[model samples]
Target: MSSILRELGALVIDADLLAREVVAPGTPGLAALVEEFGPGVLTPDGELDRPAVASRVFGDEAARRTLEGIVHPRVYEEIQRLEAEAPPGAVVVHDIPLLAESGRADSFDAVVVVDAPLATQVERMVRDRGWSEDDARSRAAAQASREDRLAVATHVVENTGTREDLRRRVEEVWADLHAR
Candidate 1:
């Protein structure tokens, strides 16, 4: 979806990239993470060990909230800066994973959900991303359900088809966005 938007000249603010940027080695976000979660979250070279941090917070709601508290504000600040810098009338797409889960679905002018079935998601995680089936399932389970995402979706880009199908759907969505 982000790639499609960028192709259409939209300004894309990716939450995943911003998350990494905010907590990169030597940043105050990383410093705060280390202070809270300790050196185990760092690699031997002192860079953030993302997998290690994930292990620490994975099933612990409190730990996850702590991590979110440390990272989300910085990400939001950067996103605001990017939005402010965008040219007037340019479409600004924020590619966020947890819009519904974070209770932020209403924050945007429109919500475009790129959705695939749970089975397809698990299969893609295993086949394309090299994740174990159980791991993929677990990750999927941790996210907002398909119904939840759809409930907040102003437009749904179903990705249960071929790449060409996805491209066509995205183009249709781009047209709709422009129509509005």
Candidate 2:
């Protein structure tokens, strides 16, 4: 959806990309993780071992909070920096995976949630990411409920359809945003 928005001329700042950049190798985010959870969170080549970190954090509330504390601020700072570079009158979209959980839904001009049913989400995770159904469900449980996400949505891209349908829906949403 964000890619569609980008194609429609919105300046999309991707949080997922920033999340990875913040933790790359020798950055403070990585150092903090090493300090808090030890170097086992790192790959043999000293990069973040995401699965290892996920295994340790997802089931434990405190550990997840600790991880969030280190990463969120850094990502936000980078987001601010990138957004500041947007040209005047440009449509700036923050493509975030955890907007509702981050307590920042109110921060955006409009929140566009690409929503799928839980079954769809689970199936996608299991199929696309090669995660076990249990791990997928566990990860989903770690985040805010679907209701919480929907409560804050100003626009929703219903993602329970075919690829061409998604493109058409995104185009409609893009048109709606401009129509406003």
Each prediction's whole-model lDDT (CA):
0.90, 0.93
**Model 2, which residues run further than 4 Å from truth?**
none
Best candidate, lDDT-wise? Answer: 2
Write the residue-wise lDDT of candidate 1 on 27-76 in tens digits: 99999999999999999998999878876786777998899999999999
Q: TM-score of the candidate numbered 2?
A: 0.97
Clashing pairs in 1: none
For all predictions, the C-alpha RMSD in Å is 1.1, 0.9
**Cα-lDDT of candidate 2:** 0.93
- Per-residue lDDT value at 31 in model 2: 98
Question: lDDT (0-100) at residue 59 of candidate 2?
Answer: 96
- In Å, residue 109's CA in model 1 sits off its true spot by 0.9
True-structure RMSD for candidate 2: 0.9
Residue-by-residue lDDT tens digits, candidate 2, 1-180: 999889998889999999999999889999999999998999999999999999999999999999999999999999999988999888888889999998989987788989999999999999999999999999999998999999999988899999889999999888878666
